[model samples]
Target: MKLIGSSTSPYVRKVRIVMAEKKLDYRFDEESPWTQDSKVSESNPLGKVPCLVMEGGEAVFDSRVIVEYLDTLSPVGKLIPSTGRERVEVKTWESLADGVIDAGVLARLEATWPDRKESERSQAWIDRQTGKIRLGLAAMSRGLGDKPYCSGIHMSLSDIAVGCALAWLAFRFPEIDWRTDYPNLARLHDKLMQRASFAETQPR
Candidate 1:
């Protein structure tokens, strides 16, 4: 199997963390979708990163889809509940965490054009995304409070998504000072990073 992704992508990091936790060995092909020569479009029509290609030419795109498939591959560390309301709750948290990454990625992509005129660049648009990120942090922090993991029991896809999104936000918007603003989130990231999977997947 080959996991195609970029180093700075939070979605990619989430899938990487899951594969590491599940102890699934696969080749990692780091490629930026933004590059003109990238093969992302070949595997996924959406042309996105974090495309997981299986041995038989089967491809799984989207971090959610890839990670969920990986969870079934090994029982070593299941990242999602197998059934019941708990499964829904875990998926809900995963959605929220993915939203955080979506907003950040939107803002970052717009900001990539530094040479654009002030009128061409919409600070308000960027603010809206950042605002979403801020709200997400507060929500996660409040919902998490004293729990070591987002699911309140064991580390799940929720933690992987939240941790990756938080780290990506910190990497892109250092001035946000999220570590100090949300101590709970800071602690969560700290604890997750203790695992080699997270530490190795940190965005550069």
Candidate 2:
């Protein structure tokens, strides 16, 4: 398998961390969808990063879909529950984390789109996106409470997703101060960063 994505993408990092945790081996083909010469569109019609090409030339796009598939490949460290309400809870946490990342990405693009005129940029839009991020963080902190992991006693896909989202916010929006705003989340992020998977996949 070959994973095509830029190191800076939180979604890509999430997939990488999952693969590492599962002890799966794959080639990393670094590609930025934003670049003019990027072939991301060939694998993913949405022109997104983290496209996984399997041995038979089959393509799996979207971090959520790819990670779930990868989890089924090996039982080294199961990240998602196989069935029941536990699965739904873990997936919900993942969705919340991804939503935060989407907001952050949109806010960053609005603030830094090169071709857009200064007059055309909407501070209101950026504010709205950032506002969502804050609200999402609050919800995460509330849901997490004092739990070591997001979904269960052990680290699930939920933890990985939240960790990636928090790391990306710190990387792209230093002014957010999520660490101070939500200490429980900060504690979770700190614990996750100690893992080799999380440490090795830190965004450049």
Candidate 3:
């Protein structure tokens, strides 16, 4: 098996963390789909990162799909729930976390447009996205409260998603100071960092 993605992508980082948690052995192909020389398009028609190619020549794209597939490989340290509302809750949190990252990534791309006019930059749009991020963080903090993980006592897909989102913000928007406003998130990040999956799969 092989994983195709860039080191900086939060979505890729989540898949890497899931692989680590499952103790799966697979090769990593570091290539950003945005790069001119990327080969991601060959494996995935959508040209997305974090494409997992199995030994049989089949490829799985999207972080959510890859993470779920990896979960089936291990009986222990399951990242997603087996059944009931717990599964839905974990999926919902994952969606929220992904939404935050989506907005942050969009802002990052818009910032790099050298030819983009000031009027086109749209500060209002950026502010709207940032507001979504802040509200998402607040909701996460409220739901997390004193819990050790996002869904319940043990680490789940929600933690993986939230942890990846935090790492993404820290990497691209260091001046945001999310930790200052969300201490619960900071604490959760601190605890998650202690794990080998989070430590080894950190975004560069």
Worst 10 residues of 1 by lDDT: 109-118
Which 10 consecutive positions of candidate 3 have the poorest summed lDDT?
Answer: 106-115
- Candidate 2, residues 100-147, lDDT tens digits: the string is 999999998998989898999999999999999999999999999988
Q: Which ten residues in a row have the lowest lDDT in candidate 2?
A: 144-153
Per-model lDDT: 0.89, 0.95, 0.89
lDDT of 1 by residue, 157-198 (tens): 889888988898888889888899899899899999999999
Each model's TM-score, in the order given?
0.95, 0.98, 0.95
Sorted on TM-score, highest at the top, how do the candidates line up? 2, 1, 3
RMSD of each: 1.4, 0.8, 1.4
lDDT of 2 at 175: 91
Question: What is the Å distance of residue 145 in model 3 from its true position?
Answer: 0.8
| Ranking, lDDT, top scorer first | 2, 3, 1
